[model samples]
Target chain A: MSFRLALQESPGNPWFSWRYVQDNSDTILAALREHAILTAEAMLIATAVAVPLAVVAYWYRPLTGPILALSGVLYTIPSLALLAFVAPYVGTTNPGSVLIALVLYALLLIVRNSLAGLNQVPPEARDAAQGMGYGRWGRLFRIDLPLALPGIVTGLRLATVSTVALVTVGALIGHGGLGDLILTGFRNNFYKAEILTGAVLCVVLALVLDLLLAMAGRLLTPWSRRAVR
Target chain B: MRSENPIQQALTWLNDPLNWTNPGGILDRLGEHLWISAAAVALGCVVAWPIGMWLGHAGRGGSLVVLISNLTLAIPTIALLTILPLTFLGFGKPPVVVALAVFAVPPLLANAYTGVRSIDPEARDAARGMGLSGWQVLGRVELPLAVPYLAAGFRTASVQVVATAALASFVNGGGLGQIISAGFGLGISVGGGQILAGGFLVALLAMLVEAVLAVVERVVTPKPLRKARGRAARRAAVATGSA
Candidate 1:
């Protein structure tokens, strides 16, 4: 039985002719893996920068207003346009360029949340901590952070979901993800089933990723339960 | 065409009367774009409300529903548009509508669920104590309270769906997206202008919808909260004077 026949015969079968589609599947999956890694990388970098900057912003509110406003403006740039603008700078199709764009996008969400979460740690709480003789760092970690955990996690979850969706667009520049399958299926007008498969897989992946993140939120932020309740 | 430089030629091409008509031409297309987005949002609400209500009433696994909604938002609109026509065929409004609905649902669902869940326990208990049946309590007590939150969700979903549907033009689904995508293909100042015009129109429409929804939300919000905020302001002023 030929690979084509197998795909045709079992159009709905995710595993149909797995070996023949191995290269293509790998390309798609590898793109997805790279997307995950890129988001994780961007999150780490952005969080590291955003957390300290948030503290600075909190301490010197007037000075950080311009920066925050700039980030808000940057957030309005259509995602694809930003990617296209960066294409020339980094040369098109480079994963690094995509990651750079993702990092900028993530920064807006991360920074906003970091600031909001910090602000949410009531002024009185900070005053109380100070009066308790805890140093700023100690107070930040012990009291403020725990209180702000739910908001911070909410921001992270939002950023991660948006990143997952945007990374699929990276497929347009030859970075293959499940989106590559969908795009290729459309471009060639071949194998409608393949397109369906890709779309379904993309939806499934999103749902699973969301569930995992929600679980993580539940676990990491003990305070989230209180918020939910 | 041959004598002119690329920029000049592109500008000349764009200045063609057929393409560059007056206010009427632009307004007609703009109207069509607005209609499509508005219709899609309405359709999404119609579709989302039942599901949102069901999830909210069930009350168990409310967080899970919100999580799913967040993920639904994560499914990039372009990817969904690109994929929709493959299996569905017939490349026009239906696919665009479906895609927009998909984009719209998450916010709607999340808002509905949140609104329902956020109701004050005493209010819910009071309704129950009054011998209101479960359905009656939900319809009367819960939904009224949830209106502002749901409206907030609707406002978010409306803007999101409108912007996303504009991208449907990439699939030949004809909305503002066609103008922008063609502009991109033109790849010059002319293309840039067209894209800008199309994008600006869409953004304007989104802003208008947001403002309209803001008004609607204010109208729909419960009176108690408004009163509470008023009281808080007065108290704060009193405290400031004392200090």
Candidate 2:
């Protein structure tokens, strides 16, 4: 018991405290779960919005510049500032404001990637589809979108990683998942172990998610693998 | 106050002269924000560029470096800002600058590496064939061609640094974020206008920096490459339109 007290009261506080982890395992796990859910939901909504926007931009030549430019502007806004701007309207009772801001932040990368992916579909391929009597919609779904999948997936990966990072800022308004732990630790006398756990978990989650997405992209586009080989 | 439009109140708050000039005012915070961002980006460039260029020249383990750097993006900025202070670094600007600088490295390093690696082999050969030493070849042929990529990296790093700099206020590293946090401290009823104003200023500043850096990027790019890119863009647009 005295040894534990001595460990706790040591002048050089250790960065990784097993005591802290053992004490607050539930809280840590809950925060990690919340962080993952928030990231997944944000990515889902962002992709849904981004794909249509990218399609519109690709189809309408004149709108492409404006659409890309608008998303670029949105992307430049700081995550915290965007959240604060959004919070007033959404009332911050839920994570609604955080989700909206994340979706906006994510639009640029996904939309750009989707458009690039669409453009990468060879004109010859489209012509072949047309000669085969495929309708415009059919060609788009069968030829264009499939070709674009890799790029769109790449965009999703990038957006998801960034969104995961940005979600921590949501803690400023009390919606930040693991960010809450980091903030609470800071507020409570610079609790190093708690802060490190949150920080490390965020990076781990990001890397694991990124790896999973890359693998999924490979599975989705098996042709890419064959071409490389 | 409850019935009044928040945006209108925000505009009024922005227009107030006292908010612009007083101690810890908008101007002061903006200065702090710019100072931290500029310092961070400069430091990032200093540390990342040399290593990136060396690795690119060496042509071994460069991708691994880039991958590792990109992985750094996953590390939460808030966590870094908050956690750094716990070390001997102590509170305020040190932690903020270090965190922002770390954030800036991935882009700068990746771009620098790609910029050098992307150079045409024949051009490098021609420079070498012209009796240029290894260092001379790099300086005269490689560096000039890499300007566009470096500019792109700089622009990305600067814009991101500026935007992320707002979090500096969290660690007592004063900036535009202070206004936002201060407004939050005052509660929505009393500080709605201030919050809106703060957000607006930060967004405006970030956009302005992006625009300025974009223009700078255009100016710095080699003239022939710029024209070629412009032509390619036009061709792409035409192709897409006809399709």
Query: How far off is each candidate at the interface, as Cα RMSD in Å?
Result: 9.9, 7.9
Please give the distance, in angstroms, between residue B210's alpha carbon in candidate 1 and its true position after superposition: 2.7
Q: Tens-digit lDDT track for model 2 on A1-229?
A: 0122333435656788889999999999999998999999999999999998998988898999999889877888888789779876776546888889988998887888888889888899989999999997898899989989987987888788888888888887777899888888887777878888888888889889989999999988988897745
Docking class of 1: incorrect
**How badly does each model clash, as a count of residue pairs?**
0, 1
Candidate 2 local lDDT, residue B130? 90
Model 2 chain A worst lDDT window (10 residues): A1-10
TM-score of chain B of each: 0.79, 0.90
lDDT score, residue B65, model 2?
61
DockQ of each: 0.21, 0.46
Error of 2 at A34 (Å): 1.7
Clashing pairs in 2: A171-A176
Q: Which stretches of candidate 2 lie over 4 Å from their true place?
A: A1-12, B228-243
Cα error of candidate 2 at position B242, Å: 31
